[model samples]
Target: MRIRAKQLAFAATAAVALLAVSLPASADVSGRAVKIGVMYPLTGKGATWGKHAQIGIRLAVEEVNAAGGIGGVPIKLVEYDYQAKESEGITIINKLATRDNVLAVLGPCFSSVCEVIFPLLERLQTPVISYCSAKPGLSKLSDWAFRNSLTSDKQLAPVVSRWAKDYSIKKVVIIHDLEDAVSKAEGSKVLPMLFKREGIEVLDILTFRTEDTDYSAQITKIKSLNPDGVGLGSCYQNAAGIIKEARRQGLSQPFVGGACTGAPALIELGGKATEGTYVSTAAWMDDPADAIQAFVGKIKARNGNKAFPYSAPRGYDSLLITANCMNDNGITNEKGDLASDREKIKKCWANVKNYPGVSGSTTMNEVGDGAGGNRVLKVVDGKYVDISG
Candidate 1:
């Protein structure tokens, strides 16, 4: 049942009970709906994440419109494909802020892109909430900048500590991507510190690039150390490859992943190798709570009965929080001005507290900018199950 993200995203055109928001379908007030731009890598190597994000955003749009259309003003999504390139992000944000004049922006899902766009926030005053960026200092770069997903430290620290205490893990090894900010911060700094606090010995640390296809050297080191646990800070594909290689190299110690690696693709790619591995993330797709299940059901029905992607929850939550901020601040189409009301929405997002969603509750923090709930997930028989305490 291996499924590509684009397939998971667009297989079923089965219309949701609610309507999908697109570009200015009927115009809200005066020949234009309140525009919110969505930027993602819809056509490149990382298009999978973009597609997953699109489905989640579309579901949120449907939910928002069903609930009387974001303060009686129907929202329109201005979607763009930056193909996961940071340079493209600069161009897209410039266009989204200056030309499209969208009130707020969502996505540009990579932290690499976030770093490039952080400077644009002060120049444009447009609030941006990233669904996948987990680097710690991103939100602090600007008052208008925010994040919907939990940073690596927030998502992984407690869960890893709990797992170590419960499993009596005394020694660990970390394999990380040196070229990535999120990966470096989590693997080289946060996870090690958390392990140290738990009295776990870090035997060694290893590095790889995002583009490396062969992990034989790293796998050999992991096999040699054979610590009580193996920690990973990597993209889904890289994590899967590493897990497969580690298993092939006879490294049987349990593996734990940071926030970004918690996705269906991990198991889909690693198969039996990923079984029994655990990862921590902001959203728990296997949650049984009514709100979580209902949201999952909608996505399944719309995606031809396939399992939901991890990114969907954050994308859906991002929209809900953004709309709630608008409602809380009373920033509406009453003034019939998108640019003027953008500042008010930004202010509201800065002050948002206890904003709940199917993914996790989020709050605008002063230091890290934004953070949310977290869960530790273990892979059993090729499926991710909530195992956090």
Candidate 2:
């Protein structure tokens, strides 16, 4: 009987030892493994931009994983191609939240899509860090939908007005793609106000659809108004198309625009036709930061002589933010728990301060909004040249 009792006690002790080895430290609870849902336009019209955003995101994930996998447990990135549709984006978000049970989500690109999906995410209490959506109404839509990109107001409006005054522009015309929500919002909300504030007459405000590449009609309309300058608030493709058509129609007169104007596509697609066009963008390749320069080199090398666009920096910065958030929160795989970990991550993200990102110093505002400042670049000699602001 004594020997039998001794054997049973030994077995119990061994079981306890095994359990201790298996369980992680109590302090490591917040370092649990997590799955992040990344929704982007991996295919379709927004695919090129979305692909760039995804590359940065994955690069961030790779760097984090290399540094010992957020908290020791690996972070699984589950991606969904929303194809640039709001309804599809919402569906993907729902799947990420409910079926896949992701801790967080990345993007749906367009502001209009973000506006639509934000309500659903708010209801689910799912945290989303959108990459590029910058509509004014986004912050008000929900606490859950956070944006790292700058609002068009802060980045575009001030630049446009300042440039107008500096150049002594007496007349201006704001032409945009009416089908695009972001462009429409920028034109309608800021056109009248900016014209009034700058004391510049808006000779005409014109709209065109994304499908209509032929801008002869729009250019004819704009020429009739005879504006000194034009403000193009649209995507890189559409903006390039408009500029090419405008130049063809001999309507060139100190044309300047926001971020999209300084894209690689403008120069690549429009070639010599894009020269002399100026754009206010959040990124410049000539930045003093070695990191940014190195990244540009890397991307250019990868693309085999293709010029890096302004959007690349935004893409890279978005990943940097995510990786930093994971590091700050002590995210790990050993704990293998996500629900509680996500909550901790959200809190950690709130405290992220002065993080050196590719774009600039990244620190979220009270409402979780951030955007790098704007620097104007002119297409001179078939390349983007920094214009003194």
Candidate 3:
């Protein structure tokens, strides 16, 4: 009897030891905090995008931490200002991945910055979700890179079709930013392709550098063409300047622009001149959905009633998506499991589908760009009205 009891005791001890060995090395929330990296061009020309993104990300982090964080571990954001410089972006990304040891990163907002940063993701082995880098197919540079924002091509296709039909635009003069990657692509590639599909003739293609403040020469040339409409491949600031110049030049052609011109800044800067201009956006600020209304209300309250840009919602969604991945994928935030945890987050990000967000339903396509509904907005009385029906 005594020998049998000893053997049973030994077996029980062995079973417990094996269980301990098989278990994960850390508890469910082992780390002091779950670190995530934020990279944005906070001080350069792209400061507007970075500011709005910061608001959204801050709100998301606050909400997550308020709700007991990810499995009771608070999220800590390691932030860096890339200043819209490719070299700065590259350095920031490396530091985020190695020095900070963050599980994932958000932003590096401009496509120019993202173009340089994304190619390094494979070697860094960190996942990055861009909030507003809308240059098409940029995310394809690395499997570790993902975008929560739609590319300019996707956002503009429907809007261009609608703009053509509504304005009876049989011909268009394409004006795009020469130096910016996204603006160049939108004007050179996306607009041409889309216009061709819509049976619109490209009357002329004009270009200007992003730093050019005076667009009178381009506007004069566009006026001479007298096309039925003008297609703009430019950001909000430049697009507004171009449109204002066209108006001043007495060019009455309806103007339509790509994703980058959809921000409130376009209307604010262009004012009455922006009226009747059409642009495509990933998010509609006037959405009647309860969640959207609440988000807008909070943003307005926080931003002193300034118009909220689409980057806000995209940034908010990016963080929430990252948090969801960390929670659902058994992330322990442990020092030893950092590599595996990052991989898990990357896999989760790739499979993101139909996530209902304030920015509409978000699904990460095979190319790593977001797939979601877009809003074709027309500037009316100083407001962007959704005419995408």
Query: Best-fitting candidate, measured by lDDT?
Result: 3
Q: Compute each candidate's TM-score over C-alphas.
A: 0.87, 0.85, 0.92
* TM-score, cand. 1 vs. native: 0.87
lDDT of 1 at 221: 79
Query: Model 1: how large is the Cα RMSD against the reference?
Result: 7.2
Sort by TM-score, top down from the best:
3, 1, 2
lDDT of 1 by residue, 1-389 (tens): 22111111211122222223221222334433667889987875445677878888888887667655554576789999988778899999999989988878998788888998987889897888888788877888888888877788877887787678656799999999876678878889988988888899999999998789899998887777878988898877889999999889877788888766777778878999998787877777667777777788877777676665557777877776665555444454543566557877777666666555666666677743556667778888778877775
lDDT of 2: 0.66
Model 3 error, position 159 (Å): 0.6
Indicate the residue-level lDDT of 245 in model 3.
91
Best-matching candidate per TM-score: 3
Clashing pairs in 2: 70-331, 70-332, 71-331, 71-332, 72-332, 72-333, 73-332, 73-333
Q: By summed lDDT, which 10 consecutive residues of candidate 1 come out lowest?
A: 3-12
What would the per-residue lDDT of candidate 3 be over residues 112-219, giving only the tens digit for each residue? Answer: 888888889999999999998999989989999999998998889999999999999999999999878899999999999999999999999999988889999889
Q: Model 3: runs farther than 4 Å from truth? A: 1-27
For model 1, what is the alpha-carbon lDDT of residue 166? Answer: 59
